[model samples]
Target chain A: MDMRAAVFRGPGEIAIEDVPKPALDAPTDAVVRVTHTAICGSDLWPYRGQEDRDVPSRIGHEPMGIVEEVGEEVRSVAPGDRVFAPFVTSCGECEFCRKGLHTSCVNGGFWGGEDGGAQGEYVRARHADGTLVRVPDRHADDEETLQAILPLTDVMGTGHHAAVSAGVDAGSTCIVVGDGAVGLCGVLAARRLGAERIIAMGHHEDRLALAESFGATDTIAARGEEAVERAQELTYGGANHVMECVGSTGAMNTAIEVCRPGGTVGYVGVPHGIEDDGLDIFGLFMDNISLNGGIAPVRAYADELLADVLGGTLDPSPIFTKTVDLDGVPEGYRAMDEREAIKVLVKP
Target chain B: MDMRAAVFRGPGEIAIEDVPKPALDAPTDAVVRVTHTAICGSDLWPYRGQEDRDVPSRIGHEPMGIVEEVGEEVRSVAPGDRVFAPFVTSCGECEFCRKGLHTSCVNGGFWGGEDGGAQGEYVRARHADGTLVRVPDRHADDEETLQAILPLTDVMGTGHHAAVSAGVDAGSTCIVVGDGAVGLCGVLAARRLGAERIIAMGHHEDRLALAESFGATDTIAARGEEAVERAQELTYGGANHVMECVGSTGAMNTAIEVCRPGGTVGYVGVPHGIEDDGLDIFGLFMDNISLNGGIAPVRAYADELLADVLGGTLDPSPIFTKTVDLDGVPEGYRAMDEREAIKVLVKP
Candidate 1:
C-alpha cells in the first residue's frame, strides 16, 4: 500500500510523492496515521539550500495522529488512540531520558529518511510505549483543542525549553530573541512560567502584534546591536534571563550581551553561523554569563505543556497563519520560505 | 617614606622597587601591611607578555596581611587585625555581591595599578568593609593557622568556585582539568563537596601526586584526545561535572568532550586562547552541555571556605610549595614561570 508524503526534490522544491506506508518494523513500534503535521522554520533550512538535503528525501518531524497499528511490545499507546510525538523519538528509558534530556537519549532517533516522514499519511514510531503521548479520548475530536496541542509536538515544547533553560520564573524578566514560530511560543512560555516582563525582539510587525497578544509586555523591532542595546535599556542593563531562539551568531551575541552579570542565555536555535563567526567566550566570561540549552528535549516538556493546553490556559494556534492539505504541501514550504506565512499547518 | 613592591619591568623581568607606601585614599579604604601573599598563575600572563601590561608597573593581587590603618568608613576590619582580600574588591552591599557574584559587583575593581600591588610592604584596600575578611584575633599570630587560611585569598577559594560552579555534590563524579595550584585546590574542593570520584588530568607527575593527596581518585597524564578518552572510560561515558582549571582552548575542549549530556562544565581558568581558537559552541550544543562560570568570584565564596580553613577541615597551605621574603620576589616569579615551584608564597 502506498501513501503520499512530502519529499525534497531540490532547492526551492517540495513534491507530494507516493511511498510505501510504514509498518511495525520492531516490537516497540507503532504505525501512526498522521492527522496533523506542519512545516517548521527549520524545514526552510533545507528548502532554501542554506543546509543540504538529499534529493527526494522525506521531510518534516512534527506529527499528531491516530495509532493505526501497534506491535506486540507497544503498551502505552494502542491502535485507535489519538497521539502526538516530539520531533525526536526516544525510548524514554535511557539515563539521559530519565533526567529529562530526551534529545540525548542513547536509543532515540529522528523521524524521516528510512523511517516515514511525519509529513506522510503514516509513519512508524520507534519505542511506541515511550514515544507517543495520547490526548485522552475525549478531546481527540475537538479541532480547536487539537490545533492548540499540535504545536506541543515541536515548537511549543521547544519554546518552553528555552524559557525553562534560561531560568524564567514568576515575577522575573525574560527577553526572547527571534520573531519566528519558536520565538512567539517562547513569549507564551515565559508568560506561562509567570515571567512578569516579556520582551520580544524581532523586526516583524504582524508577528510582534501576535507576540503582544501572547503576553509579551514589550517588543523591539530592531536588528543586531540596536536590538541588543534596546533590550539592555528595557531591562536596565540586560536581564537575568535571555532566550536565544534564532540560533544565528548575531542572535547568540545579542542574547549574551543582553544577559546581566550572573545571568543565563538559553539558546535553542539550530546554530547556523557558529562554524565561521564563533561564539564570544571572552565577553561571556568577563560578565560571568552562562550559556545553557541546545536542541531542547521537547518530549521531557510535553506533559506539563500539554496539560496547560488542555486546561485552556495556553494556546499557540495563532502562529499557524496558513493551512494546507497534502496537495498543498509544496506550496506550504514555499509560503513559509517566502515569509508569506508565519507557520504552515497541514491536515491530510 | 617608601615601601618595596614587585614591579614588572618587562616581560620575563621583575624588579623590587621602592614605591611610596599607600594611605587611606577614601573613607572606605584601609592600608594593610602584607604579611603573606602568593604568586598566581595568572600573574605569569603579563610577565610572559602573553597579555600586555604597563612597563614597570606594580604587580600581584593575592594578599593576606595585618590591617595597619582603616578609613573612617571601614567597619569590617581595624588596625592590628589580620585580613585577607580576594583578587578583586567588591562592595558587599551591592546586588551582585549580595547574590554571591561579587566579581560582577557594580562597585568592584581589580587589585593592581594605582591601587598599589598586593606584593608591597603597605597597600590600600578599597571598600575595606566589603573586601577584607578578618582572621579571628586568637589565630592572628599562629603561623600554621595563618598559612592554611592565606590561600583563601585566592587559589583555594577559586578552586571552590570551580567545583561549586560545576555542580559537584555528594556521590557525584567530577573531573578536574589541570594540575596547577588552582587545579589541586579544585580536587580538594571536589572532595569537600563530596564527589565520590575525582579525576585530575595533567602531564605533570609531581602535581598529579599533589592532586592525589588533595583527594583525586584517579589521574590521567595524557594530553588532548587521549586524556578525554581516558576520562570518558573512567566515567563509563563522560562525567556529569568537569572543572576546567586551565584557560587554554585545548583544556576547554577536553572539558566539553568529557562532559555527559545535560552535564555542565564549570570553567575558572582565565580564558586565554578563546580569541583565536574560539569555543566549540556547536559541540557544546550537540550534547546540551552548559558552560558555567568565568573568573573566580573568590570574594563571594570566601566566608564559607574561610570557615572550613579556620575549622582545620581544609588546609590548602600545601599549594605554596616554596616561600620567599620581600627581596626574593623576582626569583619567586622566575621559579613559578619555570615550573620549579607550583606556587610562591611571599612575606613582604
Candidate 2:
C-alpha cells in the first residue's frame, strides 16, 4: 500500500512523499492509520537543525491514529481502534514499567531518536498494548481537538510530570518559567492539580494570553529572575512550586528563585549546556528547596488523558492555532520556528 | 556573679579566666549556666584562624546548659530547666518561624559569628522559647551521654535535615559520603528514617565503626565515585538516597554517582564551588533524579530529638570518643584538626 508521509529532506524543507505502508511485525505491535498529528516545538528543533538532522527523517512525534491492523499478541485492541501512541516506545514488562516509570524504560527508544516516525499515513508501533492509548472514534469529527489531545503523548504529559515530580499540591502557588506549549500545558496541569496561583512568564502577548486561558492566574512579561521576582511579589513571599520548561540556565535559575524556602522546583527543560548555572547547590540547600523533574513518561498518562478528553473535562484544542495538509507540514515548521504560529496540526 | 570561662584572646590560644556572668536580656530570652560543651571542626576553623574570625572572640558553638534565669515571657521552660541551645538563634515571630524554617529568618544569627559566644557561663540566649530544647534532667547524670548529645545541637540536626530533605523512605538504600561527625550523624538519621541498607564511606576505621554503630549496614573504605560504584554493587543498582556530608567538590560528585535513576540526594556540606563538570544537571535530568538538602534547621528538630533521647528510643553517646574540661577545649580542637579524635566533648 502507498501512504503519504512528511519527510524532512533538509533544513526548513519537508516534503510529502508516497512511502510504502507499514505492516505489523512484532506480535505485540500494531499498524496505525494516521488521521491526526501535531507539530511540536521539539519537531521544530530538528527542522531548524538546532538538534542537527543530517539524514532524511520523518518529523512528527505527536500523532493519534486508527489501528488498521494488530498483531495476534495485541489483546487490548483490534482492527479499527482509535489510539494515541507515546512519544517513546517501551516494552510492557520492564523493571521501569512495573514501577510506572515507562519513559526511562531500559527497553524503550524515543521516536525522534530511532525506530520509525509518526508523521505518516501508516506507521508500525511496537508494544502496542503498553504504548498506545485507545480513544473514542466519535470524536474524529473534531480532529483539532483530537490533535490537541495527541500532545498528551509528550508535552502535556511532560508538564504533568513536572508538577507531579515537584510535588505541586492543593493551594500551592506555581510559577511556570516558559510560555511554550509545554509551559502552557504546565499551567493546565497546575490548575488540575489545584494550585491556588500560577504566574506565567513570557514576552509574547499571544503566548502569555494562551497561558492565561490555560489557567495562569497572573502573567509576568519578563524573562529570567526578573520574571521570578514578579512572580515572588505576586505570590507574597515565593511560589510553592516552580516549573522550568525552557531549557536554559536563565529559566532554570528563575525556577529555583521563584520557589520559597521548603518549596519544590520541578524542571522539565533539556538544557543545551551553555551557561550551566544549574549548579547552585549552595543556594538550593540554604533555601531548603527540593528540585526534581525530567523526561515525561507519556505512556503512563495517555489512557487517563484520553479519558479526560473524551469526557469533556479538558479541551486542549486552543493550543493548535493552525492546521496543514501533509505537503504543507514543511511551511508549518517554518512558521513555528519563526514564531509566527503557536502550534500546527498536520492532517495526513 | 563571677564565672570561670574560656576567652579566645587571639588565634591559637584561649585563656580560661574569671568573667562577668551573662544576665537576662529580652523577655523571651534565658540565661544558661554552661555545663557541657563541644569543640566542632567548624570551631577549629575559627580557632586556628583558618576561618575569618575576630580575635578576642569567645568561641563556642556547641553547648548544653541549665536555665539559671528565665525572662518573664519565657513560657516554654522556667529556671532550673535543663536545655540545649541550637547554634543559630531564631526569632519565633518571623515569617520563617511560621513555616518552621528558622535557619533563614531575617532575625536569625549564628553563634560566635555576628552573635557572641556560648563559651561563657550563664550565656544569654535570644528568643529562648524557639531556639532551645529542654534536655531531660536524668541524662544530665551521664555526662558522657550528654556530651555525645552535644553535637545534636548542630551536626546531628544538619545531617537529619539532609536525609529528611531528600525524602528518605522505608525499605530504601542510602549512601552517606562522609565519615565526619555530621556524616556519622547522617547514618543515625538515615537509620531512624527507616533506610533498610546504609553504606558509609571514609578513610578511618574508627569512624567507620562509629558509622556501623550508628546504623550504617555497609561500609566503603574508598572515596569519590569508586565508593559510589561499591555502594551500587551492594545495593544492586544505586542508592535511593545519598547524603553528602563532606564539604568538598569530590564528595559532591560521589553523592551524585551513588543515586539511582529517579532517586534523591541530600547534600549538607558547604560546597567550595567547582563548576566545570556539567555532570550535576546531566544526572538530574537524564536519570530523572533529584538533589536536595542544606543547612539543618536545628531548632526545628532539637525538641523531638531531645524527646527521643529522654524516652530512651535513641542512644547517641558512642559518637563522643574524647572528653575534656573547659581548659582542654582548645586542645580538643587541635586533636580534631589533626584527625586524632573523631569528636571531642568539653565540660565547663
Q: Choose the strongest candidate by DockQ.
A: 1
lDDT measured at residue B42 in model 1 versus the true structure, 0 to 100: 92
- In candidate 2, stretches whose alpha carbon ends up further than 4 angstroms from where it belongs are A1-25, A43-60, A119-122, A224-226, A326-330, B1-25, B31-35, B41-60, B67-72, B77-81, B93-95, B118-123, B247-249, B274-279, B323-338
Measured over all alpha carbons after superposition, the RMSD of each candidate to the real structure, in angstroms, is 2.1, 3.9
Residue-wise C-alpha lDDT for candidate 1, range A222-276, written one tens digit per residue: 8878888898899889999999998888888888899998999989998886757
Q: Per-residue lDDT tens digits of candidate 2, residues A156-252?
A: 8888888887787799878888888788888888888889888888778889999998899999887655766678789887877888887777777
Clashing residue pairs in candidate 2 (N, C-alpha, C atoms within 3 angstroms): none
List candidate 1 segments past 4 Å from native: A9-11, A52-56
TM-score of chain A of each: 0.98, 0.92
lDDT of 2 by residue, B128-193 (tens): 887777766677667656765687788888888878866777876788888998889888888888
- lDDT tens string, model 1, B169-233? 99999999999999999999999999999999998999999999999999999987888899999
